[model samples]
Structures are given as structure tokens and as C-alpha cells.
Target: MKKSDVLEQIRKIGLVPVLRAESESQALALAGAIADGGVTCMEVTMTVPGALKVMARLAKERPEILLGAGTVLDAETAKECVGEGATFIVSPAFDEKTVSYCRAHEIAVLPGALTPTEVIRAWDAGADVVKIFPASAMGGAKYLKSLKAPLPNIEMIPTGGVSLATAHEFLDAGAYALGVGADLVDTKAIRGGHPETVTAHARKYMEIVKGFQAGCLI
Candidate 1:
């Protein structure tokens, strides 16, 4: 998908499921569960084992869902993930090399940033969006809201401590979208071999987010 299209989809969905799978099989199942729950965007973090291979499988098999690689720290991994069919890229920390690599390749990049300086640096580095990592530590929605006054143009995705209940608050506070991990996709449920539980949890979050978007609670 085109970068513009991917960004638009992320804005529409309001939340992107972040998955860390121990194996390819588990990743496949997680992808299916998220997709089934009405969320078509996912971020597969490289922290998990076989992340690249799992990302490749999801890209090839689940063409309907937008696939992104998260926790990307360097140029090599960024290049490999994009080549393997990552529609977009995300990083835990601001990395100039990684951002430059994505920009050179014309792939969308969302590098994690905290302060205004870091956020601006990421944008200046050509990041499609700046992820506010551990946003809760920075004061969550209130922090994002504070930045809007001075840096309204910076697109941000608040990850870490973003829950289904507070997802809309971040969006309303000026976040472009949210990168949800454990809150949306229960790792314990998945590890327990209850993929359906994951699906159900995803569906609940999706409904809450979609409802807020539609301006109808019920």
C-alpha cells in the first residue's frame, strides 16, 4: 500500500495492534485473531523470535491487513523489514540511520520520541509519524495535548500505557493514532492457547474506538 494510504488507514482505525510472537505459528494465529476482530492494521515487533519471517508471512498471506514492523533499531533491520513487505516501520527510539533508510526506500517510518526536540528531530528525519513511547510516563493524553499548542503539525502515535478505555482520549488530545500492545492483544491469553480470547478483546477495543469515531456510543 502507498504511504499516504497507510497513514489514512491508521487515522481511521484509531488503534494499531502491536504483536510480539514467539513463533511464526503464533504470529499467524494472532494476526488472524486481530483481523477477525475488525482491526486490519497490525505492528509486529522485532523483539519476538522470528519477527522478520513472521512479518513476511503476514504480508504475503494477509494482504487485506496493513502490516508494519515495530521496535526497529537500525538501518539493516529497517531495510530487511521493508523489503520483506512491511507497509510501514516503527522504532522504540529515535534513530537517524533507521529513519534515513526508510526515507531513502520511500517506506513510512514512525520513530519513538519523548520531548519536543526528539519529536521534531524525528519529523525532520522524515518520519511519517512520531511515536511517543511510554506516553504514560510523559503524562499520557495531557502531554500530547500540551504539544498541540506548540507543535500542532507533528503527527504522533501514543504507545505504552494506552488502553481501550483511554484510547479515544489520546485521539481527542491530538494523537494521530495509537499503537496498542498488551492492552489490546492479551499476551497471557495468547500464551494460554486461547486465541479466541484475543479476538474477543480486540473486538471490544475496536468497537469502543469505532464507536467514538462514529460519534455514537451505543
Candidate 2:
């Protein structure tokens, strides 16, 4: 998909399920479960043993879903995932090379940032979206609300501490999107053969996103 189109989809969904799994099968299965719950976008972290292949397989098999590579620390890994059909790339920290490579490839890149300086630097480096990671430790939604005053146009996605209960607060605080991991896709539940649990969690989160988009939660 075109870069703008992919970003628009993300903005509309407002929640990106970040998955860390024991195996590619688990990741893909969890992805499918989330998809079944109406969330078609996901970030498969490189922490997974074969993350590149996992992204490739999901992109190929779940053509309707948008797949991205996460924990992408460098340009080479970013390029590899894109070559393998990842529609987007995300990193825990901002890297100029990684941002540049994704821009060069016309893929969406969300490089993690914590401070105002890092956020602007990532934006200046051509990040499609800035991920405010470890967000809770940094003050979560309230902190993000403060950033919007001066950086109104910069789209910020706060990850690492978002949950179904707090999803609406982030959206109300002006998060362009949210990156949720364990809270949305519990690794233990998946490992214990409870894909349904993850699916149900996804459904609730999407409901909040939908409500926010419709201005029902404000």
C-alpha cells in the first residue's frame, strides 16, 4: 500500500497490536485471532526468533491485514523486513538510518522517543509517527497531553503502557495511535492455548478506538 494510505489506516484503527511470541506460529496465530476481533494491523517485534520471516508470512497469508516489523534497531533489519513485505517499521529508539531507509522505501516508520527533543528529532528525520515509549514511566497520557500544546501537528503514538481501560484517555489526549503489547495480546494466554482470550481483548480495545473516532468517548 502507499505510505499515506497505510498511515491513514493506522490513524483510523488507532491501535496497533505489538506481538512478542515464543514462535512464529504463535505470533501468526495470535495475529489471526486479533484480526478476527477486527484489528487487522499489528507490529511483530524482532525479538521473536524469526521476526523477518514472521512478518513475511503474515503479509503474504493475511493480505488484508497491515503487518509491520518492530524492535527494528537498525537500517539493515528495517530493509530486510521491508524486502520481506513488511508494510511498516517500528523501533524502540530513534535511529536516523532506520528512519531514512523507511522513507527511502516509502514505508511508514514509527521511531520511539521519550522527550520533546527526541520527538522532534525523529520527526525531522522523517519518521511518519513518533512512538513515545515506556510512556507510563514518562507519565503516560497526561504527559502526551502536554506535548500536544506545542507540537500540535506532530502525530504521537504512546506505547508500552496503554491498555483497554486507558485507551480512550490516550485518544482524548491526542494520540494518533497506540501501540499495545502484553495488555492486548497476553503472551501467557497465547502460550497456554487461549487465542480466544486475546481475540476478546482485541475486540474491546477496538471498540474503544471506534468510540473515540466517533467522538463518543469524549
Candidate 3:
């Protein structure tokens, strides 16, 4: 999908499941479970072994879902992920080279940034979204709200410390979306082969977001 369309989908969904799979089979299963729960945007972190292979498989098999590569740290990895069908790239820190690579490839990039300076720099470097790493450490929703007055156009996705309860808070605070990890997909559940727990959690979150949208319409 095009970058703009992917971004729009993410905005509408209000949450992106950040996943880490140990094997290709597990990765596909997790993707299926999340997709079934109404989450179409996923970020498969590169921290896991054989991440590239898993990403490639998901890209080929699930053409409808928007696949993103996360934990990308360098230019080479970013380029490789884009080639492997990553519609968007995310990093834990702001890297100019990685941002450049994504922009050159016409793929969306969300480089992690904490302070306003880093956020602005990432935007200047062409990051489609600036991820606020460890967002909870800086007051989470409150911190994001502080930036809206000055940088309303800078799309920010708050990762780390975002839970189902606080997901809506982030969006209401002007975050483009929430990047949910452990809280949404418990590692123990995945390792124990009970992906249904993750699916249930995803469904609950989706319901909360949908309710919030409904309230807005009312």
C-alpha cells in the first residue's frame, strides 16, 4: 500500500500491535490473530531471529495488512526492510541516515524521539511520524499534550508504557497512534502457545477505541 494510505489506516485504527516472533510460523500465526481482532497495522520488531524472513513471508501472504519493521537501527537494515516489503519503518532512536533511506524508498519512517529537539530533527529528516520512545517516562499523555500547541502537525506515536487503559488517553492527547507491545501481546501467552489471549486483548482494545470514536460522533 502507499505510505499515505498506510498512515491514514493507522490514524483510523488508533493502535498498532508491536510484535516479536521467534519463528516464521509463530509470526504468521500472531499476525493472523491480530488481523482477526481488527488490527490491520503491525510492527514486527527486528529484534527477533529471522525477522527479515518472517517479514517477507507476511508481506507475501498478507497483502491487505500494513506491515511495518520496528527496532530498525541503521541505514542498511532500514533499506533491507523496505526491500522485504515493509510499508513503514520504525526505530528506537532518531537516525538521519535511516530516515533518508526510507524517504528515498518512498516508505514511511517513524524514528523514535524523546524531546522536542529530536522530534523536530526527525521531522526535518523526513520522518513520516516521530515515535516517542519510553513515552511513559516523560508523563505519557500529558507530555504529548504539551507538544500539541507548538507541533500539532508532527505526528507522534507513543511506544513503551502504553496500555489498553491509556491508549485512548494518548489519542485524545493528540498522538497519531499508540504502539502497544507487552500489554497487548503478553510474551508468556505467546510462548505458552495461547495466542488467543493476545487476540482477546486486541479485541478489547479495539472495542475501547471504537467506543471512543462513537462517543466523538455523538
Report how far residue 143 has shifted in candidate 1, in Å.
1.2
User: Which pairs clash inside model 3?
Assistant: none
lDDT of 3 by residue, 20-99 (tens): 76676777788878877888789988986788988898888888778899999999998888888888899999988988
Best candidate according to lDDT: 2
List model 2 lDDT by residue over 1-218, tens digit each. Answer: 89999999998887888889888888888889999889989899999988888888887899988888889999999889888888889998999999988888888999999999999999999999999998999788999999888999899999978998788888889999999988987878888889899889889998888977887535
lDDT, residue 42, model 1: 89
Clashes of each: 0, 0, 0
TM-score of each: 0.94, 0.96, 0.93
Query: Which candidate ranks first by TM-score, i.e. highest?
Result: 2
lDDT of 1 by residue, 1-218 (tens): 67788889988887778887767777788889888888889889898788988888888888988889989999899888888888899988999999888888778899999989998988987989999988999888999899777999889998987887788788788878888888766667777888888788888878877777777434
C-alpha local distance difference test of each model? 0.85, 0.89, 0.85
Residue 128, model 2: lDDT of 91
Model 2 regions more than 4 Å off:
216-218
In model 1, the worst 10-residue window by lDDT is: 209-218
How far off is residue 90 in model 3, in Å?
Answer: 0.4
Q: Worst lDDT window (10 residues) for model 3?
A: 182-191
